[model samples]
Structure formats: structure tokens, C-alpha cells
Target chain A: MVPISYYLILAAVLFSIGVLSFLLKRNVVTVFMSIELMLNAVNLTFVAFAHRWQAVSPQAVSGQIFVFFVMVVAAAEAAVGLAIIISIFRTRQTLNIDQINLMKN
Target chain B: MQLALFIIFAALAVAGALNFLLQRHPINSALSLVVVMLSLAVLYWSLGAEFLAAAQVIVYSGAVMVLFVFVVMLLNAGEEERTTGSRAAYFAGIPGAAAVFCLLSFVFLSESKTLGSSNLGGYLNDGTVNIVEISKILFTRLLLPFEVTSILILVAILGAVVLARKEPDPKVVTSSTDAAGVIVIKEKV
Candidate 1:
């Protein structure tokens, strides 16, 4: 049996990596990917906790259900976000986040 | 056996995430993300969330990643240029991430005894099938949110279509108007 802490620690590591990439990366798409990674990390944590509590109560499956909703939201976000990225690229002709400062005047 | 599988897939997931960060091209990063998602799906399976494991693979690795790759190819995005970047991000971001990791690790480790342990496919011993148990709750307790997500998907589709459509060229519109004006002038003459 793996300690629940191990799963949580892995999730924490993944999330930190996501944050690092989100901060350091210049490309908008890659930053978006990092956000997805963060969401994935959170989903992992939810599943881990759900598994941990499954022995206690049947309602613990709600964690997995929450993950379902998270995935749904992620799918919607990806669709809309990539479309927004496409439009941004169409107008700016660049994907670098630093150069995208039209409103920074 | 379960511990070995968890360690292997966890390593794969971390490696994929690091590759995602290191890649110079968006396409490479996107592919690395797919690897991470797949490995996470395996982890989900190990955790006994069978339906979630399948959904993770199908929706995340399959659908969302395909969307990312399509956009990357459509835009023909080139390699990311290495910029010196802002001093603040360099000074703050790495430390911030490290701090967050340390904080989470400390908390989780401290609570490990209370949080307990999990076995691979441990939930299967309960005799209820995983998918059925999930659906029973999902359709009953979680039905409202389920319906809401359908609406959310619909809105996303509409937004994507509207946002990604090419703007009508102002130059083409002006030229068409100019042509119409010339025809009107010639008719009058």
C-alpha cells in the first residue's frame, strides 16, 4: 500500500512544475498547457483523497465525481481558450506572452 | 507490485512534465503534456478510479490534446525565442514554486498518519463495480452539475466558432463598395 501522502506529494510536485512553467514560459500556448497540468495535478489529489476515504464511506466517490466536473470544465476551457489564443495570434502574429501588451500603454 | 507500478508511472509523469517545461517548441510541449496525461491516467487506474482513468485518457489525452496540436499546427507556431525575461519572474517564480512545493510536502507529510494509505484497486474488493457506483451517484446526486456541463460545452463550441472565424477583410469590403460606386456612376453617365 502506498501512503496517501505519496500521492499528495506527487501532486504537489506536478503542480509546482506547472506553476514554474506558467511563470517562466513565454509562449501563451505552453502557459495554457501548464494551467492544464496544474488542473491535472489537482485532479490527482482529489482522486487520492477519494481513495483514502473510500474505506470510510461510500459517498467518498464524490471526489471522483468532482474530477468528472473538473474534466468537463477543462474541456470547455481548452476549447474557448485555444480559440482565444487563435484570435490573439491572428491579430498579433506572435505567441509570446511578453509581446502581447496592447493594453499596457 | 502496486508500489512499483505507482513509482514507475509517477516517474514517467514527472519526467513528462519536466520535458514539457524544457521543450522549445509548443508542439513538443503539447506532446509532453499528452504523456503526462496518459501516465496520470494510469495512476488514476491504480487509485481505483476506473471511470476517471478512462475519462482522463479519452477526454484529456485524446480530445484536449488533439485540440492543442491542431492549434499548434494551424498557427504554425515556431520555436520559442530565448529572452532574458523579466528580472522579477526569474527572481520570484522559481522560489515561489519551490516554496509552494515545500509547504505542501510539509503539510502532507505531517498529516500522513491521519490520511492513511491506499492499495491499488483497493475499492474493487467492495463488490460494487466502479462505474456503476459512480454513475449511481453522478445521475442522482450530481445530475445538476452534469446538466450544467452540457450547457458549458455548448457555450464553448459557440465561443470557439465565433472567436476563431476570420474577420471580414476591411480592404475587400471597401473595394466592393468602390466597384459598386463606379457602376452607379457609369450608369448615370
Candidate 2:
């Protein structure tokens, strides 16, 4: 038997790495990728909790349902975000966030 | 056996994430993320989330990642120029992340008592019944959100087309449309 806590802790570690990567990376696409990583980490936690609660709330399945909504939103976000990135690249000719700062001046 | 599977796949997932982060080329990072997503799907399957595991692969790795790779190719996104950072960030970032990991581990480990140990296939309700119940709640309880998400996808499609369209010069539009028609004619040829 694998402890649910192991999954929870693994999710936390992945989340932390996502945060770290988001902070460290300068490429806009990589940053977006990091955000996806964080989203997956959260999904892991949701599934673990869903498994734990299945015995208690057999009918609700709220945790798994939450994961479904998250996946949907993520797909939408990816489509929109990539399109936005394409436009930004068209205008700015760069994918580096450090150079895309227009409002800073 | 279950524990071994968990450990192996979890390690693969975390390693993939790290490789994604460390890789400089956007394409490389994108591929690494594919790896991470695949391993995560396996992990989801282990957790008895059969539908979710399948969905993760189709939506996340297949669709989302293809989108990412397409954008990378379209934009010709180059390798990021490596720059030296503030000493403070490197020195502080590692330790700070470590501290947070330790803290979270402590909390999760302590709370493990309530979560209990889960065996593989512990969620072995009737497979068909599982899908039926999920669909029941999805169509009934969560129906509104589901409908809204379809609308959201439609809006996103529109937004992508709008955002990616070339500037609206009337002559350019006509010329491009004519060129697009030529493309179709050429395709048939």
C-alpha cells in the first residue's frame, strides 16, 4: 500500500519546482510551461484526495470532477496563451519576457 | 509492487520536470514537458483515475503540447540567452525552496494518519458503474459548468483567430484571401 501522504508530498515538491522554474526562467514559453507544471502538481493532489475521500463520499466525486474542470480550463488557457504568444512574437520579434516590458517605461 | 510502481513513476515525473526547467531550447523544454505529462498520466492511472489519466494524455500531452511545439516552430523561438543573475537569487532560491519542501513534507507526513494507505485497485468499484456515476454527476450536478466550458472553448477559438490574424488592411485582406484561394487550387493540382 502506498501512503497518500507520499503523493501529497511529491505534489508539493513538483509545485515547488514549478515555482522555482517560473522564477528562474526568462523565456515566455518556458514560463508558461512552468505554469502547466504547477497545474499538474495540483491535479495530483486532487486525485490523491479524491482517492482518500472515495470511501466517505462515494457519490460526490468532487475531487475528480475538480480535476476535469481544471483540465478543461488548462486546455483553453493553452490555446489562448499560445495565440497571444504568437502575436507578441510577431510584434516584438522576441520570446524573452525581459524584453517584452512595454509598460515599464 | 504498488509502492515500487509509485516510486518509479513519481521519480520519472519529477525528473522530467527538472529537465524541462533546465533545458535552454524551447523545443527541448517542450519535449521534456511531454515526458513529464506522460509520466503523470501513468501516475493518475495508478490512482484509479482511469478517465482522467486518459484525458490527461489526450488533452495535455497530445493537444496542448502539440500547440506548444507548433508555436515554437511558427515563431522560430530561439535558445534563451543565458545571463548571469544576482548572487542573491541563486543563494537564496535553492535554500528557500528546500525549506519549503521540508515544511510541506513535515505537514503531509504528519497528516498521513487521516489520509491512510491506499492500495492499487483499492477503488475497484464496477468499471461501468464508475463511468455511469461520473457521467451522472457531470450531466446533472455539474451541467452548467460543462456547458460554460464549451462556450469558453468557442470564445478561445475566436480569440485565437482574432489575435493571430494579420492586420486589417482591406487590400491586404483581399489579396490574402485571393492567395488563400490560389493555395486551394494548387492543393488540388
DockQ of each: 0.82, 0.66
Model 2's DockQ?
0.66
Q: What digit string (tens of lDDT, one per residue) describes model 2 on residues B1-189?
A: 999999999999889888987899999999988988898898888887878888999999999999999888888889998764445556787788778888989999999898898757546565543556668889997899989999999999999888888885544222223644653322211
Clashing pairs in 1: none
Off by over 4 Å in 1: B171-189
Give all candidates' CA lDDT scores: 0.91, 0.85
> To one decimal, what is the Cα RMSD in angstroms of model 1 from the true structure?
3.6
What is candidate 2's lDDT per residue for A1-105, written digit by digit as tens? Answer: 899999999899898898788878888998998899999999999988988887676554678889999999999899889889988988898888878888889
TM-scores of all predicted structures = 0.92, 0.88
Q: Taking the tens digit of each residue's C-alpha lDDT, what string does model 1 give over B83-104?
A: 8667788899899999999999
